[model samples]
Each structure stands twice: as C-alpha cells, then as structure tokens.
Target chain A: MFKRGTLVVVAFVLAVLLTACGGAPAAPAAPAATDAPVAAEPFKVAVVMPSTETDLAWSQAMIDALRSIQAEMGGEAAMQISISENMFNVTDAAAALRDYASAGNQLVIAHGTQYGTSMFEVARDFPEVSFAWGTATDTGEAEGFTNVFSYNASAEEGGYVNGVIAAMLSTSNVVGIVGPVEAGDAKAYIDGFEQGVLSVKPDSTVNKTYTGSFGDTAAAAEAASTHIAAGADVLTGSAQQVVGAIGVAKERGALWLGTQSSQASLAPDIVVATQLYDWTGVLKDIIAKIQAGTLGGTAYDLTLENGGLKIVFNSAFPGVTPEMQAAVDTAIQGISSGVITVLP
Target chain B: MEQLFTLTTLTGILHSTIRLATPYLFASLGETISQRSGVLNLGVEGQMLMGAFAAFFVVVTTGSLLGGVVAAIFVGALLGLLMALVSVSFRAEQGISGIGMYLLGLGLSSLLFRLTLGSVQSVRGFAELALPGLSSIPVLGPALFKHSLLVYVAFALVPMVAYLLNRTTWGLNIRAVGDNPQAADTLGVPVIAIRYATVTVGGAMAAMGGASLSISAVNIFQENMTGGIGFIAVALVYFGGWRPVGVMLGILLFSLVSALQIWLQLVGIGIPSDLAVMLPYILTIIALALAPRRTGQPAALTRPFNRGMA
Candidate 1:
C-alpha cells in the first residue's frame, strides 16, 4: 500500500512539473476582420501589462487604445498586435519584452511603470526594436538608450475634474480618497483630487487614506467602508484595486469618482464619473515616430488638450446636475488651456 | 482624536474588524487543525486563491452561491489531497512541497480565470443576514449581528473545533498521531489516515476562508486578491499555540489593529499612513513575542510516518 501511494505521489508531482514547464498558451485578442488584403509583412506591436487586459483600469485602457489604433490603421493586416497579460513580476515582464523583441515585434510597449528598468535593459539589447513604457516621461536619453520611449498622462487634470464634480454632488461635504500608494500616478491623482475639492467647496472635509498596496482589494474595501463611516457621501480613488471600493460604494449608495479609466460600468448607479486615460494619441505618435525611423529618445504626455485624458460622466446616474456639469466642464477647459494649473 | 470616540465611529470600526477578520479566522483555524495533525501547509494562501477563484467563477456562471462554495471546498480538498500525497506518501520535505503547492494553486487559478472569465467581474454575493431582533440593538447589534451567514459559520466553528480537538475520541487519535506517530502506530492507531484526514479538512476550511472573502466580504475576485492573508493565517497558528479559541483571539487582535489604523486615517490623524499600516504587523509581533512559551506544538509535525522505521 505504501509503495502504491508513493508511486501515485510521484506521478502527481511529475504531472504538476510537466504542466508548469509547458506554460499556458498565450491567448491573443481575436484579430479584427477587414476586407482589405493582408499585408505581406505587417507592422507588429507587442504589449506587456502588469494585470489582465480586462482589468477595466490601467491595463484595459492601453488594450482599448491598441484595438482602437488597429481599427483606424485598417485592422490586423495593417497593424498586427500581441499581448502578454498578468506580467506583474519584473523578471517575467523583462523576459516577455526580450521574447517579443526577438520575435521581431517593431514596437514593444511595457504598460506598467514598474517595467521601466526592465524595459530599458531589454531595449539596450535590441537596438532596432522601439520600446515604450509609462506613467513616466523619462525616455532613457540620459541613460543613453535611444531605442526606448516613455509616456505619461497628466492624470491630475482629470483627477481635478472628477474632484470638482464629486464635491459639487457631495451632500455630506466630506469626500474620501482611497489611494493605493503615495507614489507614482496614484499620488498625483490623489493630490489633484484634494486640491480640486478644496477649490470647489473650500469648507468641505477631504479625507485621504493610502492602503499602501496596488492590489489589496480587501484593504481597499475596508478603507472605503471607513470613508463612508466618516460621513463621506462621495469617494474617489485610482488604480485597478478600486473595483473593491466600487463594490462597497454601490452597496452603501455612495457616489464614486474614478480615475485611470471609466469605471461606471462597475456600478452604474454609484460611479458618477471617471477620469479616463486614452492612450491612442500616445500610441499613434509612437507608431508614427517608429515608422519614420525615429526609434526613441522622445517622451510624450497625455493631456486634456491632446484629447488623451477625458472625464466621462455616467449618464445612468442622475446626480450630475446641469450646474455640476458646467462646473466640471469649466475645470476641464481651465486645466487644458493652461489658464488654471492643476498642480501648484 | 476626540471625535474618533463617537458611537458611529466605534460601531463602524467594530463592524469592519469583524468583516476583515473572517478570512483570517477561517484560514488560521484550518491551519491549526492541520498543524495539530503533524503537517504544516504553507500553501494555505495558494489554496485560498484557488478557492476564491472557484467560488467567484461558479457564482458568475451559475448564479448559485451554494454551488460556488461547494466548488471552493472541492478544489481546496483536492489541493490538500495533493499535499498529503506529496508530504505523507512520498516523504518529501514538507516545507518545499507546501511552497510548490502554493505556486501551483496560484498559477492554476489565474490560468483558469483567464481562460474562463477572461476579466474582472463582480457578482451579487451573500447578503447581510441581519438577525431580526438582535440586529436592532443599537451599537452592538449593528456591529456584530448584521453580517452574512458565512461570518456566523466561521465564528461558530471555533467552539466546535475546540470540542473536537479536546473532547472527541477521533480528536484524541489525531493528537496522538501528531504527537508521536511511531508510538501511535505501535498502539494500533491509524497514523497515516488521521494525518490525511486532518490535512484534507484543513484544505477545505482554508478554501472556505477564501470563499468567505470573495463571496461574503468583497463580493469580487482579483488576481492575488487574498493578498498575504494565507501566510498570515499560518503565523497566526503559532500565535494561537494551535488552539481554535486562541486563533480566534489572535485574528481579532490583528484585524482590530488594522481597523483602528483605517479609522485613524479616516479621522485625519496626522500620523503617516505608512506607519499606520504597519501598526497591525508590529502589534502582532509584539503579542507573539510576549505569548506563552510554545507548548502546544505537535511533536511529530512535518515528519512523514512509516511503520517499522526508527
């Protein structure tokens, strides 16, 4: 009996090891159909994202932009695309970057800021391959890497806009910010949001809490609950983890202001508006530069003026009165035209 | 700070503490049972992830909360059975095998989720089952009585588990096997069977703990959504000295500290948020260090038992 049990155990371990070795097949997005004849050699692009492409936040925004660009360029035949999702580990992301470059992808976009170092390291080896990454603006020119490109979104612009609407709709005069960490785009969005709230309703209380994690949904939910408990009728936060907070807001009937992407779909009744990051403008520019043989050494910023950042309010939620809409529109125009700076 | 003492704030913190501690309670209680039976499943986190995914997947597909829970239990037990085969039968190093199980669970669940659902989706999970009369009793009622059914099950398991471990004959046999497998073997106790049973039960409970999060507390599943709760549950077993009630107290303490920090930040306290977040871990370490000498640890833990050996 012991011998049989040992044999079974050995077989199970071997099966698990084999499965691990034979990694899961990559699921590429279905190629869009077009009547145009296929190009002999298409302009291939590969993207590596930290979370799944459908996270409805950071990663989703980029994938949506890629698909949009593909459609505009006459579909998959004109612009071939490949994606590696859930590449949260820097080592794995670096490996994916190198693999895509070796496979002759013309433009490789590493979609998370955490991949900046790894992207640069991989960019050095493939001089002919154009690489892009962001929520940052360093193009690695100082580090002397010409094949690398960087982009950043003026997230504070939309964050400020969302804040204005949230403050306008808030009945409690207490708004809450559920932040992921006190760094990167999350910090910028939170800071801009607070400023926007204070600018609109100077006496309103703005409470902020950082869960110190990018993906701890449980913590985010608790933080949201705490916010609601403290008389916050309106809440706003950034990062993919806000899905948890959104669920809480929906349950408690508190209005949620989103950033990074349009999260109204998560809770149509509660998510009043979102600051969406539209990367097509940035992607188009990068593609244009690569096609023109300007491989890298330039940084791009997604601003409201460039139509890369947008504040999309949910029409399902009737909380956005005409007065509130006008206020939000004014804030958007002020931030975009350089008349009112988002950050002092 | 003085404003933080309001009835509303205190009730909110208490409510949050209970909700947050549910997963820990489930994971640590299960870990306690497994540890008492001579196995240390470090892969509880992985099992929890698998459980979370399975429950969420089932609920989204079939809209049956019961089916989701059963799926979690089934997947968790399978993983636990795999652990038993590796550690108990193959005589592999328990620590390494447990880590392997953890990685496998994490990877497999993520893969399955991508293949099936392909995105983050939410479901209407278990609703708060407010105990009719009890739920109306001002502060305590709202804080303790108005929770999902899973919360009650998790807390109810405490005394049940304590009784099973201390009063029942099967519990005595399990204790004997974990304490001295060879001696128990000589005494005609089924040492291997007891270990297998305890470990499998541990896996089911751990998965249920995960289900509590996805289907009860958060009502959504994200990749690595359980975060580090599983590993913390393992440490909590040590903190509780392998007792169910002790484990409950430890989970509550950790969760209470976490809730307090959230409240402190919400009240606009001037302390750095980073330091506030660290409060729970710091307090947990201090409590563990000040805990009574580790006297309840099973003697034959992590040791694969074989007859006619040693």
Candidate 2:
C-alpha cells in the first residue's frame, strides 16, 4: 500500500512539474475559419526590438503597434512578418537584419536607437530591403537610396511640457534631469526643457546628469539622489524606465516627471506628468506610407502637431491648479500655432 | 546640508555590501566545497542562471514565491547531478565539461524564457522583503534585513558551511578525499559518492545565489544576467583561502565596490561616474593579487579520483 501511494505521489509530482514548465504555451490557434492562409505576393517586414516586448514601455509599445498592424492584415499573413527582439548588440542587429532578408523579408524595421549604426551598415548591403530606424539623427541619406528612412518624435515639444510643469512646481527654482545617453537625440529634450523653463522661470537653473545607460536603475537612482541633494526639487528624464528617478523621488519625497510614457503610476504622489510618445501612431504612419507607396526615404519628424508626442497629467497632482493646466495648454497651442518654435 | 559622504551613506554602503555579498558568497562557498572534494564545477554560473530562470518562471506562473524557491533548488540539483555525471563518473575534463554545462544552462534558460514569454520587454520583478522587527532599525534595518529572503539565505549558509567543513565528520572525509583521493579510497571512504554529493550541493547553492538576483535584486532576467558573477565567485575561492569565512569577506569586499559606486555617485564625489563604475572590477583584481597565497587549495582538486588505483 505504501509503495502504491509513493508511486501515485511520484506521478502527481511529474504532472505538476510538466504543468509548471509548459503552462504558458503559444497563443491558442486562431479559429479554423481564421486559419485559412491568405495568398499574395509576399512583402516581408521584419521588426527588431532592442529589448523584449514584455518590458511594457518603449519596446512593448512598438510591439503592440506592430501586433495591431499584423492583425489588420488578417489573423495570418501572406507577407512574412517576422518579429525579432532582445537584440542587445550591434552585431545582433546586423545578424537579425541579414537573417530577415535571407528569409525573404523585404522591409526591415530597426526599432532601437542602439541599432542605428548597425542598421546603416547592413542597409548598405541589403539596399533592396527598405530600412526604417527609430532614432533622432539619420546618418543614412534622405531619399537618396531606395531603402533608408528615419522616424523620431519631436522630443523638444515633449521636453517643453515637462519643463513647464517643473517650472510651475519646482519650489527650489532649480530642477534636474537624468539622461540615458548624452547624444543629439537626448539633447533635443534638454533644449526643449530649457526653452520651456525659460518661458516661465527664465532664471531657473537646470542641472542635468547622464547615467550612460538606458535601464540601469541603480545608476538612475543614484543620479536622482544627487540631483535632489543639489536642491533640485523636480527631476525628469527620457531614459528607458527613468522611473528609477521617480523611485528615488519617492524615497526622498521629491517631485519628479518622466518622458515617453505615463509613468505617473510609478510614483503617483510625486510624478507631475509624463510626455507620452505615441509609438503606435508612428508605426501606423509607417504602415500607411507602405500601403500608399509614398513611403520615401525621408527623415520623419513627428511632433505634437502630428499626434506623435502628448503631455499627460496625473490626477494625483491636485496642487496643479487650473492656471497651471492652462499654462501647459497655452504652450501646446503656441507650438501648434507656430508662435513658439520648440528648438530641434 | 548633510555632507556628501556621511555616516548614513557609509551605513547604506555597508548594508548594500551585505545585500550584494550574498549571491557571491553562496556561489563561492559552493565552489569551495566542490573544489575541496577534488572536483572543479565550472558550471556554477550556468547552474545559477538556470536556477534563476526556473525560480522566476515558476513564481510568475504559480504566484507562489516559496514554491518557486523550491522549484529552483530542484532544477539546480538536477543540473548538479548532470555535471557530476559528466565530470565524476565519465571522468571528463572538469573545465570543458563545466563550460558545456554553462552553455547548455544559459542557452536552455534563455530559450525557455523567450519560448514561454513570447518576446515581451520588461517583466515585473519580485517584491522586496522587509523583516518585521529587524527592518525597523535605523541604518542597519534598511541595509540588511530589508533585502530579499534569498540574500539572508546566502549569509546563513556561510556559518553552516564553515561548520560543515571544519567540525563535521563528513567535512573531514571530504577534506581527506580532496587532499588525496587515492589515499581516501585506500582507507575505505566512498570517495566517488562524496565527490558527487559535494558537487551537487555546490550546484544547488550556486543556483540559490542566482535565484536571489532574479527573485530579489533585479527581479527581471536580462540576457547574461549572471554578468560574470560566476567568475567572481571562482576568484573568491582563491581569495578566501578556500575557507567559508574568508570567502564571505571576499564577497563582502566585492559587494562593497558595487555599493560604493552608487554611493559615490549619489554623494556627487565628482570622480566621473564611468570611472567610479570601473573601481569595483579594479579593486577585485587588486584584492586577489594582495590576498595571502600561503593557504594551499585541495591537492587533488580538478582531478578525477579513480578507486581502481587503490
């Protein structure tokens, strides 16, 4: 009887083990009707993410947009749409792009700023495969080659919004920013922040620090603490999960803001607002251009005017009076009306 | 204004020193024991990664942290057994076999994560644990007890390991076998069985160290998340003079460097942040070079003990 019970327990353990390891399988097969494979001349589009899609931030937004595009084509596709993620190296980018093209993917999207150099190098080889890069600066020729194009947000406008909030909320007359990397792309936001702050508190001092990494939370937290120690009451950044700054702010009870997404949820008490970049809109434009055949190799400068950047305020910031809200509204109108040109 | 470098910051650094020290301590301790048993387990890093992946995946799936820890230990043990099989029974090259196991573990865990999660970006990490009473202490509380349960486990294992190695009969046998496997075999000790046991236990402990990173510290598993912590553990073995207490000190020193980088940056020490980051690695090399080399490692370490010679 003991031996039988032991056998039964062993079987039960095996079942649990298998279930745990293999619990999450691929999305269930679409209905039989939806499974009918559509046929057409294949136009291959390969999407590459620097990180995985589960990140729920920049990479996730891009993946979500791509998924929506995939869904629009149908449950299944005639055009081979391959999505590659977690490419940390420039080498990984080159390999994936080559793999996509070799696998007959005609259109390749390098969906990370880090992939800019790699994409440009590989694009020279695969001129037939149209390349789109999400970066601030485009080293690739504009409409010269039949392949390369760049799409980036007007972070200047987004930065201006956060600057306006910081100017209004900062009690110390000093604010700080923790940048991911000090580059042209990151500089645009800083310029805009300066412009926005000067628009309100012309004499306000902006102390900026770069963590030299996109997602090193320890560095971000340390940088934020330093900024806070320097009498900066408000801080903001455009880094990946700059929420580490908010985490610091939460620990020290300092005001903070973020760019690229609604991270007000990160520290609801401290976060004034976030400049949400609509990556879906950016992806939609790419798809639309592809569909229209007007997608030329040009630097796509998407702005608030084009629904690329938005300033989202948190309801938790009750201290933000209607006058403060109106100030932000006025700045948005000023940018849209061409009265205020946010520096590029 | 509080001075940039204050007692509070120093205390924070010390606490962080302890928190980061755990994984390295656990891994090196495990490696030390394995080495002491005349076996070189090069698969500690891989075993740790596999353990981390298994633990994290299980927790995410079942929503039970304790179950995840248990699952990680099982996965670690299985990998350890595999390592022992190739290195002990087959008498394979310990280093090469270890490298193979590392590659397999890293590749398998990453593949499994991607296959299971379907290429999402950042997954949420585990919540931090705050000990009810201990966490209330001003500086030490947040620095020590406020860390993950796994971190605490790493420290606890240090004393236990020291006792196991110095005071116990099995420990003496392990030392005897590692020092001279053929001699131990002649004396009627089950040299092979003990080697397997030590190597297996070592793997499991190393895995637990890995679980600390995934389930406590970072909570998110990135590619190559071990970040050469395994190698650091190996170096610690030599630095600690193959002793558990000495190994913990090495772990503490390494952790201190990591914490110091952050603390310096926070206090605006003005050394250029990049340079500050490099200090830990530079310090590691210096510490290794300066450590007393008098204490000899196990004589038969990295060698297969053949009982037939007896």
Q: Which candidate leads the pack in DockQ?
A: 1
TM for chain B in all models? Answer: 0.98, 0.93
Q: In model 2 chain A, which range of ten residues has the least summed lDDT?
A: A26-35
Q: Can you write out model 2's per-residue Cα lDDT over A1-344, one digit (the tens) per residue?
A: 99999999999999998986775452232233333345344445788876656553466656666666667766345445688866766787778877875555656888877787777777787775677888644736653565677788788897887799899998899888877666655668877987888789999877766666666544565567556655788888765546455656765678877776566655678778877767666666665565555443667766878877788888887778888899999999899889999886
B148-182 in candidate 1: lDDT tens per residue?
99999999999989999999999898899889989
DockQ of each: 0.58, 0.10
Candidate 1 chain B superposition, TM-score: 0.98
The deviation in Å at residue B194 for candidate 2 is 1.9
Model 1 residue A259 CA deviation (Å) reads 1.5
Writing each residue's lDDT as its tens digit, candidate 2 over B1-310 gives 2544565665667666776687788789999899999898988889988988887787778767787788788888889999999999999999999999889887898789888854322224445588999889887777777665677778888899999999999999999988998888889889989989998898888888777766665555554567567777888888888899988887788778777675565455577756776787899889878875845689888888676764
**After best superposition, candidate 1 residue B163: deviation in angstroms?**
0.7
lDDT score at residue A99, model 2, on the 0-100 scale = 81
i-RMS values of the candidates, in order?
A: 1.1, 5.5
